[model samples]
Target chain A: MSHNTEVLDQKTLWGGGRSPFNVSYGKLMIWFFLISDALTFSGLLCSYGFMRHKFSDTWPSANDVFVHFPFMGDAHVPLLYVGLMTFILILSSVTMVLAVEAGHRRNKKEVQIWLALTIVGGFFFLFSQVWEWAHFIHGTEAGAIKDIIVDGEWVTQVVHGANLHHNEYGNVLFGDFFFFITGFHGFHVFSGVVINIIILIKVMKGHMDKTGHYEMVEKTGLYWHFVDLVWVFVFTFFYLV
Target chain B: MERDDIIEYSLDISHTDEEGKVIRKRLWKVFWILLAVTIFEVGMGFMFAGVAAYKDMLMYTFIFLTVVKAGYIVMIFMHLGDEMSYLKKIILIPYCFFIAYLLFIAISEANFIFDIGWVLG
Candidate 1:
């Protein structure tokens, strides 16, 4: 009886070697973490969607709500600044991927340059978010969205500035949601920037070069991209929709 | 001398490779695709604003475009497109279902609240 005795490589279906998923353990773990993080953001956004839908008629329009332009003194520019912030964040994501590609080739200098630009981009985004948060809290000249009797008729009231309890935009709930969601997202971006700075220092110091690979950069790139991805959804659900 | 027999050592500044070209091209392509989509979304937002008749249609469109942009970012930038099929499925399947479940529950509850007229009424 002839026996089939061909030895299978460790990569074979039954044989386990190094990376069954065809990716490193670090990358796989990052993917898992990101998936969970995504669920959290989705929950928050869905809640926003639900509230807005229920108050479709009474909800403040994004156009009338987010019309502040920096240094323009009450010009109704609509989504211009937020749109620019979005573009900058997207550009930063592009730079991050470029850094990852450079890392794959073990090009340390390219990695450093790209990473620095990415950090700058991250800082810019963070600053923009802070400005936005401040503007949101300070609101337009009108005030918190409330009910006021005008000429013996009850009508919607617009006020200036907002806190956890009061909102100058539309509904107090709108202010609450805005602060919680955007603040949460901004914190993520801040963490990403901190991580990138750490990685940037490592690259500049040639630490990654001694390791013979740039997997750390790639791993961080995965995270930064995930942050960018979340912002896309947030911008839509909050700013556009 | 056979070209395939030559061993390549990647330096900090070396830019010579056939494979690198392909990757760079793909990177540029992804950047352009993302930029184009953002511009398109902005244009649509401007066009459809203030038109009461198109409110529902606008919401659906925004959601669709947002999904498209998110897909491209995940697939390309996150390198999921280059990963194995099983790995992709392992990550994507659960995520899609979970988000859908959340949306379903949240929307239903919001509608219930609306019907009860507790907050607004």
Candidate 2:
């Protein structure tokens, strides 16, 4: 016990802050958190894939479901608005990286401009999510429940606008998964926007500039990129596939 | 603080030299790649919508493109590529195994449920 106490006192907890990995402690912690978060997302996506494969025949085609574009008035443009949303988010990510680059050079003006653009991008994506959710909840065409004779009894089947118990978009579980996954992702976007805004304020006020290293901007860039990364998967698995 | 310390904190003039231009070029490269992939995805979606015969192939393609886009974003935009290779492996390798495990379990369970004839639609 005494030997262990001496070792601990000399190095582990009592030593000056050191990163044996050659990375900053803050960055390492963030990467660890991101890895864990990735696992959570993977679990959700894999479960979604399993459910999709099991109900392959009856699954609602994403094209059929997300055909509405803003002000198109039932023009049936499949994936147009969602595609726009994806592009906007990606563009924002570009701005964020640029901002990080500017921070590296300590260009306050460039950082402020790029960070502002990123915030705008985040807002647009979040707005698109709200629009999509509204349309999904209201449904494009009011679906009807059909009755089919199965085993000498009428089986009532519902098909479009989704609720907690039922969904017209093929399976209730599909709606459940869609809402849960996208909603969670949207929440992340919302949080990222808020964080960006806060950091932008800090940059504008020269608070972060005083730190010599704009690691805060870099950290936020990591987060924003992770959000974009997750969206890429969501776009493929949910909308495109 | 000393004048030298203040000077060091206030400005890193070397960062704005040739390195800044390279950084800008890299940022644009990442942006263009992501945009191209997205355009391709949208184009495929438009072409293959309601086409039952091409569905599975299209899905596979989308997955491939998505993975590619994600890898680029992680490696470039997130600056993970600039990190030490060992650190990169430490962060990425375990996630691969975990994903495989998750997929195996969920897919197998889904198949078992399908075999048992319990489906929700």
Candidate 3:
């Protein structure tokens, strides 16, 4: 009886008046959403792995394929540009965490500055991806020669670059996976930038100040970090591995 | 409780100059760690290119390093490390099992298909 009374007297953490996770509903929901998104990305990556393994003998080596560096005509610098992209994304993730920290202190100016830097980093990354896609679509001078059936007749032709129909790379599926996975990730970064802009505007308008908390910034920071996390996997599995 | 009251109650924003400094320091540390690991991976990739003997080892190393970087990003940047222990488990535990199972299934299936000489066809 005394133990029950003591338990009752103490503050009940899970008695329905407060969050059991010690997080706001919005933040909790964001975490759940990120988890689900992570699984979806994993599914795509695993399928990529399956296909690559199935075509192990003829799979295109990522190093040989991604050797183009801007302003270095015909230079074979493997993984350099993508490495730089990874660096930019990680740096932006740092700025995003700093913004969330500033929000914790209710420092509006710092949050705005950091968030703007993050947005700039995002745009730079998107532009780099566009440049990469352009180079990928434009094949090398010495493209691969392969046999293909056109209008019920087999023809031998030199295929340059990549598209849904075919790829200069060994397997056509490589181009498909590259387009789908990276395109999906790029879309995420685009949406993340848009969300960050909206949040920055809200901060500038003193919305967070009025609310007496910066949970919104924290939530968005979670999302931005998630994007960065996905990129890390893509960089490794798709490029380095 | 009112919605505003719930929001107010859930607000965990407590900050100080010292706390901010510590956080900034930690964030920079994670950034450097990620940068170093990436450089190391690239270096390894360059060094071991076309080395058939070390192919499996290099692939495994890359996977391990990638997971380590992911851990840092999630724990520190996403602030999952500061969340309640149960919440952390709730978010992480399932992913571990789920990814492992999916990879196992996909790889085994791919291997079976490759063995039967059906992949290229």
Candidate with best DockQ: 3
lDDT of 3 by residue, A1-241 (tens): 0012123323666677656666777888999999999999999999999999888877898888888889999998889989989999999999999999888888999999999999999999999999999988887989999776678888889999888777898788899999999999999999999999999999999998887888888999999999999999999988988
| Model 3 bad stretches (over 4 Å) | A1-11, A149-154, B1-10, B119-121
Runs in model 2 lying further than 4 Å from the true structure: A1-18, A146-160, B1-14, B119-121
Candidate 2 residue-wise lDDT, B1-121, digit = tens: 4543111311321265478898789889889999999999999999888787997899789988988998999898988887756578999888888787888888898888877888464
Cα displacement (angstroms), candidate 1, residue A221, comes to: 0.4
**TM per candidate:** 0.87, 0.87, 0.94
Per-residue CA lDDT of model 2 for A1-241, tens digit only, reads: 0012222333443243533344555677888888888887888899899988787667888887888998779898888899999999999999999998888777889999999999999999999999998888777466858454457886896544765556666766788899999999999899999999999988888897576778788888889999999999999989998
**Which candidate gets the maximum TM-score versus the true structure?**
3
Candidate 3 has which clashing residue pairs, if any? A139-A161
> Residue A68 in candidate 2 has what lDDT?
92
Q: Supply the TM-score for candidate 2.
A: 0.87
lDDT, candidate 1, A88-114, per-residue tens: 999999999999888877778889999
Q: Which 10 successive residues of model 3 chain A have the least lDDT summed?
A: A1-10
DockQ of each: 0.32, 0.40, 0.55
Give the Å error, residue A78, model 3: 0.5
Off by over 4 Å in 1: A1-11, A144-158, B1-16
